[model samples]
Target: MMEPTAAVPADGSTARRIAPSRGPETARIARGTGKQWRLFNAALSHTPDFAYVFDLDGRFLYVNRALLELWRKPFAEAVGRDFFELGYPPELAARLQRQIAEVVATRGQVRDQTPFTDPDGTTRHYEYIFVPVLAEDGTVEAVAGSTRDITDRLRGEEELRTAAAALSRSNLELERFAAVASHDLQEPLRMVAGFLTLLEERCAGQLGADARSYIGRAMTGTTRMQALIANLLAYARLGEVGEAVAVDLGETFAAAIDNLTSRIAETRGTVTADALPTVRGDATRLLQLLQNLIGNALKFRAAMRPPVVHVSAERDGTGWVLAVRDNGIGIAPAHQERIFGAFQRAFTSGTYDGSGLGLAICKKIAESNGGWIRVASQEGTGTVFTVHLPALE
Candidate 1:
């Protein structure tokens, strides 16, 4: 044992006690042992996961601090104890013994998931691995393993499965309802519009100016209603196209322009289109999508500028991106998202006359045809509508 001491002045005028000296062997041994134990504690006892070693006979050899704390058993009581004596369920103890035996026989590793209950009665899931520890003679000495808690991971997977099932059912019901309602409403609307036309033709001469004006307003209302119903039906039938075929988008663009020829002439709009790509989708629906987007550019023209729309296509990883750039009054940032929703219009109907279903229908059609749509706009500058579609090989 070393004794405590007080130092004297270097002049040797005061009394002093000499300090005891331990030999170099003692100092070296202390330094080596300190470093070894510190590393061992960090790698095993202080680790987050549960680590343990047991013989092929199922006797516990060592358990790390994490496992000891979980079991609420001290090393003195846990060491050398059989798996069952350590409070593991008999079935679990036997299953673990089998896995350890297999690892020893194969001289390899085995991994598995096991459910465990802590001393506090909280059940947890563990993903564990067993590795064989071999003796000097290559015989099975023990099995070493670690287990990570995975209860949260299993719970998340179960929740995702449940949500996916619910969403699938909701989509099916919505499709059925939209199809039936649209089909049923078409006939009655047609009859109302036909009778209104007949009344205007038959009673025009006999009616006063006010009555004639009222009839004209009624005709306009019916016309707008008919357009709404048509858009609704088209939206419902979007993804219902049976199978996609190779479609030349150049032809599709031409067809869309032809459908809107009168409107283009009325607005004095000029459409310049680049060479378009051939894509895989229903040509009729693709034509409709283009028609709506081009018509929108024409209708929403700036008051001072003649609408100049440019149509172009380019390849975008595994798909084609077609852009319809318009020199029109661009959409406001605040109203951009709402305009794509059914019956949602950004501008007042008085300023921009529409049923507000054009963009919504375009979105649905794009999605149904294995594509999607997006708009980039600035309030007073201009707007560009981009559509992404899968290209034909």
Candidate 2:
């Protein structure tokens, strides 16, 4: 064993003794080949991280000031000791010894984390790495280790997880309430609609023009209310749908056009499409997404021309971008982002007959499938809605 030598402080402060282990090989390195020991001690002594060196036998050969402060011990007590002799718990000490042995045996690095309670009774999480210290001949002479306190980082991660769980529960409860309320309200709305129709038929000759007009307005209000409620329920229950799978975009596009065949014929609109790609998502939701976009294109057509809606697809990296372009009364830039929010519309119900949940539903469906939707338009020219979806893996 070499005698403990005083460390040269970089800041001209009081010196501390660093002991070298009992062995010709390790003692020679620890004695400092010229000024190497002094430089090493000075660089690591004041660092916040705990730095130390261990011999092949897992005995402490050197420990920096930070480590000594953590243990709340002097050089005399900790320098010549292993983890077990320093009063570390049996399990922790054994694990650390094994890591140190592995580093020496493999001549490589070992990384791990553990929780430790300091002498001051404050428990902290630590991430540490052990690496072999090789001699000039490429032989493993010792194992050098560094440790950092990661308690704050771990605490932050746990807090984020707790907040996310709380938010998820709240959303689930809200969705359930909306679905139940929507279902209950439908029967009453149907009854009101039915009664209005009967009143209009039976009292057609007796009622005056003003009285009939009031009844017509009432019926329209009830119809709009029913549509709003249905859309709200669909929005809330988006998460309750089945899991996603590979779906053929071509089939979904064809189905949407077929469903809108009557409306297409009534407006003399033209719907065309190029070959679409397969995507990873719920087929039902994808169909709904297409229907909503295409429906909006048809509903918001320019007064001077028949609706011209074209659907196309192109590759976007590992994903696919599906575009629905229409020659309709385009949206203003200010309303582009707002249109994706529930109950938001660029135009009033009188101008466009819609529940205002179509684009919002499209946005939700795209996001739920690890994709997104965006819009570009110049009011009075036309509008383009592009939906990015993941390619089937």
Leading candidate by lDDT: 2
lDDT of 2 at 78: 78
For residue 52, what is the lDDT in candidate 2?
A: 88
lDDT of 2 at 114: 99
Candidate 1 residue lDDT tens string, 14-43: 112223337877566555544554455456
> Model 2: per-residue lDDT, tens digit, 185-259?
988998999999999999899999998999999999899999999899899878755678999999999999999
C-alpha TM-scores of all predictions: 0.64, 0.83
Error (Å) of candidate 2 at residue 294 is 1.7
Q: What C-alpha lDDT, on a 0 to 100 scale, does residue 271 get in candidate 1?
A: 90
Decoy 1 TM-score against native: 0.64
Superposing every Cα of model 2 onto the true structure, what RMSD results? Answer: 4.7
Candidate 1: count the clashes: 0
- For each candidate, the alpha-carbon lDDT, in order, equals 0.81, 0.88
